[model samples]
Target: MPSSLSGRTVLVTGATSGIGYESARQLSERGATVLVHGRTPEEARAATDRLIAAAGADAARLRPVSADFARLEDVERLAEAVVRDHPRLHALVNNAAMAAPERHTLTEDGNEIAFQVNFLAHYLLTNLLEPALTSEPGGRVVNVSSSLHRAAAIQWNDPQRIRRYSRLAAYAQSQLALTVFAADPRVTAVSVDPGICATGLLPLYGHEGMPAAEGAAHVVHLCDPSTEIVNGAYYDRSTRVAPAAAATDDRTVKRLTKLADLLVGHTA
Candidate 1:
């Protein structure tokens, strides 16, 4: 795997900590030029340094990029910077996501924080970088989704959850939307459920699961060139599985994509 990605470049969002950090480290060790993205410049730099230390002789392959997912403008800027710096991105790992916000809050863009960060921002970024992704063969887009999506439904009438809000529901809905979006055929894409990792996210809910590194393995496997995983599929760790019924609905996917485009102000 290391030799396969020796000359390739990939971006891992939310690489500042948790599963994202572990995923970045693994990819860097595999000789991939990793763009480590965080919500802040300071954290991004720190994560990049950690990855460099872990990569040893491959230190130079890691780069840092920061963008607050809560801000759509920041997401747009992040994508533009990525295209300007890396003209041909071989893969994209949309691993950045947020959950368990104590209260329902709206971002500056007027979208719910979880909805924007967990799905819409990645949606916009992937679309913006479509050209770079398709410029090379075997380009991949891995969306870090969750099994919890199976228990949630898209709030079509209240997509933002303004009428009724629950942190769990918001997070699951965002993941479901992402799974639906990953079904698009424009690029080689897959949605992954990293299992219930004992990351910082779990503690907020009064529980813990597996280590972050263990959970990251699922993402690393998807990024592997040798994996026979099909595009537009959902996986629980390394096993392909059916996602929520809504996620498999063609009509739902289209509706979600249309709403996402409107939210991100993307014409297409």
Candidate 2:
């Protein structure tokens, strides 16, 4: 691991607010070029401006990137743009996500809204950006997963939850899938449950949570080259622990990868 992030480039998705935003700020403060991703171009630019103004981040080190995760095409375009512009991306923080709506909803891409936005889109985006990802020792992917994943199971045949729907279940399933994705051999990656930070998704945790910056700290810690990590590891804040059994199963990783590829209309 490098002693400093100087010259390293990192992309943080869903960076417009909360932990994602804080993570971007912290990364920029550490001297990495931070690609701040948001759902829209306006939001992306505004986030960069906020980082500059509020966090004292170098404006030159922050670049705005946008794509709506609800739309696979948007994720594809976002991936293409990043790969073209930053071919040596040192790390990718899969931090963008959404709470499942109270009512069951499907994205235009025909998958459960939360599943598409939280998991599948990231699945597609990470794979698409493979060409851009750095192969250096410290280069890796950090999945901002959730503790709730332990209680969820992927509905293999009905991932869309069309027949029975519970917002909590839908969201948990997505998180579980993301955790499982960390085990993929194609990328060096790890997943972390940021300890229930107070954010838009706090309601799902059923209690008061810590500040978003604290959670972002856990995420930024993993992004630091000084931190030693193994692929497929799961962490609860700064401590590493076991993830759900399914998340570590090789068969499960392969299955989820296939399912995600199919869901996002990607081959392999």
Runs with alpha carbons beyond 4 Å of true place in candidate 2: 1-3
Clashing pairs in 1: none
Per-residue CA lDDT of model 1 for 25-47, tens digit only, reads 88887788999999998999988
Q: How close is every model to the real structure, measured as TM-score?
A: 0.95, 0.97
Best by TM-score: 2
In terms of lDDT, the best-performing candidate is: 2
lDDT of 2 at 217: 91
- lDDT tens readout by residue for model 2, 1-268: 4256889899999999999999999899889999999999999999999999988999999999999999999999999899889988889999999999999999898999999999998899899887777555567899999999999999999999999999999999999999999999887899999987889989999679989999999999998878898999999999999999999999999899889888888996
Q: How large is the C-alpha RMSD of every model relative to the true structure? A: 1.6, 1.5
